[model samples]
Target: MSTNFCETATRVLDIEAKAITGLKTYINQDFNDACQLFFNTRGRVIVSGMGKSGHIGNKIAATLASTGTPAFFVHPGEASHGDLGMITQSDVVLALSNSGETEEILKLLPVLKRLGIAIIAMTGNPDSTLAKLADIHLCARVEQEACPLGLAPTASTTAALALGDAIAVALLEARGFSADDFALSHPGGSLGRRLLLRISDVMHDGSQIPLVDEQATISAALLEISRKGLGMTGVLNAQGQLAGIFTDGDLRRILDQRIDIHQTLIVSVMTRNCVTIRAEMLAAEALKIMEQKKINALMVVNAEKVPVGALNMHDLLRAGVL
Candidate 1:
């Protein structure tokens, strides 16, 4: 028999998309109650399930943990042997069972209840035992499966996953979870670099900073710029405070002026009131200044306006803030 692959794929997508949309109707008072339970829980959220529901539960637990609610996944089958010790009286259990009658999850229900641990059940059958036993029953009911055989846990799992995300976001909002808090949890990511990396962390300080005396010649300034390799040098006053900055752009502007680099002092041609950044500011903020002012580098100064550090686009690029 001939089969249309694209048509079947399209039908599957349509079914799954509808399954996600169908979850909106299930966002009732039960959803709010579940969020309240998670928000108030001093201990972690323990997500337990069997089979494909187990995989979905694992992801749900991770989402909750990352978004501000503390959670982790535990296999219900394992809970019976010794894993039940992991669930404490302070924790809450989010059990996943599509039929609301998984033997493995149901087996742990008694222990969970005995410990006075709250059970939030996500199931397709509200009349099922798991649902009846739960303290909060979240209806993740789906109209049908995307599988043509109508036996697999396709649409049902999709609906449940969406509901889990909704619960996570609701709790995140309730806790006033901010982007900086998320970046802290996810420090290895690009967002973490952009948010957590400060100018002091990435800027070159001490002898690495290119500096020249205000009375120094252009040739001396160029030597400092090339030696430090930051494409610029801060012109410092006799008090060792920043006076102005000389960049490669200034070098180009003076090229045709017939002024001798050996004779012309740096202070004569340096850009006054040059853009600067503080060491405590975010590296991302430094990038914004560079982009807006159309410059490649910044001299990090202190409250005394002394140049303590130097950074360029290359520094930001290396720090993964660009």
Candidate 2:
């Protein structure tokens, strides 16, 4: 790598660190008040900025939206050209600018004020017009830019991004937002699959479930396991209650005892205290139980302790819960 490239990277890191440290003082009541305003707003948060600030604003909007807060990004330049219609009195505007004096953002302030929209200004200069005009001001000031020329927005942008995150997280906690709620917003993602997928959704039911009577011979149980392809069979008593479980591991133990599979009753050789999970339980929760017990499969039982379904590690793997 070039020496100049390494030097530039170091400068970037230094400025970003300074920017984060400078944000300590900015985390006071004003930040909380700003969060309250967004949380209470009936309409969406309209984040607006220009250039790099705009990019950061987009991400902040998305984070807020995915975390149970309604939000969307708007371009200040576009707002001036009639997109201001997107802003309403019930909505809150979060304006981002390093100097707090971007002309394009300033142009929309009048319309925003006329509509009675609340403004939360994120700026490096608290004394700037945007700061003075806003209902709440979040100071994203930095000691210096990372740029060698001292004109770029490196430090200031980092401060703004961190402040945005702080607001989103605070609101998330205040609203009692949870991982399950986040998964709802990201249903197509891996997190959603883990939290939303249930054992009933991945478990084998009906004829696919490996089952055998307690009176069944070990050979018969083995045939059921082979036919069901789960490497295990649920042993049910004559009263249709869960008696025990016969798995490949149980067979290994039985063989070690020199038991004859063709003659031994499945219940006599099966594993007692078999681990079982309910069909209504989340697949992720079931996976944790399986892992903690160091097992690979679980029989899904109903309220009466009857085996209604079955699942194994392969089921979790195929469902993306692994």
Local accuracy of candidate 1 as per-residue lDDT tens digits, 267-301: 99999998899999889999999999999999999
lDDT of 2 at 218: 91
TM-score, candidate number 1: 0.79
Per residue, candidate 2 scores C-alpha lDDT tens digits across 1-322 of: 4478887798799879988987998889998899989989999999999999999999999999998899999999988988988888889999998888899999999888888999999999999999999999999988888886888777778888888898899899999998788878988877889989988999999889899999999999999999999989999988887888988887777777888889888888888888899998899989999899998899999999999999999999999998
Q: All candidates' lDDT scores? A: 0.93, 0.90
Q: List the residue pairs that clash in candidate 1.
A: none
Point out where model 1 deviates above 4 Å. Answer: 1-11, 176-197, 213-220, 235-246, 249-275, 281-295, 316-322
Query: What's the true lDDT of residue 270 in model 2?
Result: 85
TM-score of 2: 0.86
